[model samples]
Target: MILLRSGAFFPLIVMSLAFASLVLASLVTGAANVSFEDLLLDPEGSSLLLVSRLPRTLAALLAGASLAVAGVIMQMLVRNRFVEPATTGTGECAALGLLATTLLMQNSSILAKMAVSSVTAFAGSAVFLTLAHRLPPTQPLLVPLAGIIYGGVIGALTNFIAYEFDLLQYISVWMNGEFSGVMQGRYELLWASGVLAVGAYLYADRFTIAGFGKETATGLGLNYKSVVVLGLAIVSLITSFTVLTVGIVPFVGLVVPNIIRRFKGDNVRATLPLVALTGGCLVLASDLIGRLINHPYEIPASTVFGIVGTCVFLWLLYARPQRRV
Candidate 1:
């Protein structure tokens, strides 16, 4: 118990230190260099600090936290830690929703696009769940594999539409995560993810129980179906908001939760804070590195995460024990 608690608590501390460093890095290092003294005294420096870097950092923090939490919830509900929104079709569905709305409405507002994308994402999740429930128990991996295939189908459809309508460039732009454009008015959409995160925290215990198996959860007097639906809804909402705000971030969700579990065990409630902290730190670090590495022309944060997370995921595939059914 002591060792477990120590390990769990240690990551939170490390993440906090990392987060602080990233924040300072964001403030100190940018396209235009403003000295500490100038940043402290100059009105224009202060405006840049408040208007630009601050919102970017907050967006990164919120996006990371939301994606990580959504990944945890999806893994628990599906009982597969390897599963995430990217793999399970939620991101693709949201992108498809955006594409459909763009094609149909031509010039819809971001808010309308978000609403359409969120609903489409939720519907995709519902289909996945329904199919999983109907699949034979002997083929346990079939469901998630099906989700991947389903996502591929949706992605192909999205591509077809984008190509046909000559909107491929627009699609590509929104498909990659970028923090560069985040400003004060634009970032309010991310607050939806924050609200969903709070909902996840409130229902954390039910999720933990649901992971034990539907029958067991039902035996415990929990409304298993409702809980599953609610969790999926929250996951869809977070994924949609994330895609809307900064585009699709691939594996922060998958990587962060597994890393947290290494130190914190598998208790959802106990691990939530660690997950949030690690996610925020990882995104912040990636954003800072992306900015500094290219100087004036910045790389997207998702690209950095993709490179790092892919290597980590490959290592985990070989190093970790297979999950028991």
Candidate 2:
């Protein structure tokens, strides 16, 4: 009847086990190796697990699921599978908002900063949507091209301002995706994305319907404009919380949903969980690989995903099979 009918569930079972193993690997790897036995005998290992490892894993899962769903919603709303918060101007606008607050309100709490960033994100995404709406929909490649240029312009402006004000170091920290510094109290805000994912799931059908165009959705008793706005709001919140907590990571949203959609069709209602699960798995795997690649030192998740996701995205664009079973 749906994606579940095609034996997708088996792959999900396999992915779930893989995800569990990765989570364990995250909890176990690091400068201070942790084991289950350490929980009973080694106080230092226990503290490391509790304070750093667990929080880092939670942050990756939350960000992954949040961004994956956010990407699906964006692609559906814009009718382009390549668009995302990073490719659009959402993350840049958020970084700009944080920079503004740093200069203007030195005493602002992180939550307040996130509020400002969300507003900026909404504005930036609105601009991208407007511009995307102007593009020729027949050429899908043009959509992400315009988005990347748009994001680049915004990001460059933010960087220029950062340099002028000597905030480059702080902006640098806010612009890269890394899990090395995530710890208790710091990474908890990432769960906001997880909560929003639940709402995204409930509205999955509406977003999917909207992708078929306004007339189709309207004929089906859907409020197309409202759905778009709601989707953008959800994306804004996810983008804000994610960038505010862990800097910006690219392609999780763009890559994961597209990968799942290839097999599951466009039925987001049936595929949303897989999207979330796969997103979480990819990010967790990236973080784990980053830890091991450089040994006692570390690479950022962005570095790993940048190389890997770019290759996968290219393959999807070019080498993707001409036929699907």
Instruction: List TM-score per model, in order.
Output: 0.92, 0.96
lDDT of each: 0.85, 0.89
The parts of candidate 2 lying over 4 Å away from their true place are 1-6, 321-325
**Model 1: per-residue Cα lDDT over 272-315, one tens digit each:** 87787788789888888899897988999999999999998887
Candidate RMSDs in Å, in order, are 2.8, 2.0
Q: Which ten residues in a row have the lowest lDDT in candidate 2?
A: 32-41
lDDT of 2 by residue, 7-95 (tens): 75787988999989998888888876567678547988788888888999999998988999999999998899888888998889989
Give the clashing pairs for model 2: none
Query: What lDDT score goes with residue 222 in model 2?
Result: 99
Q: In angstroms, how far off is 25's CA in candidate 1?
A: 0.7
User: 255, model 2: CA deviation in Å?
Assistant: 0.7
* Whole-model alpha-carbon lDDT for candidate 1: 0.85
lDDT of 2 at 12: 91
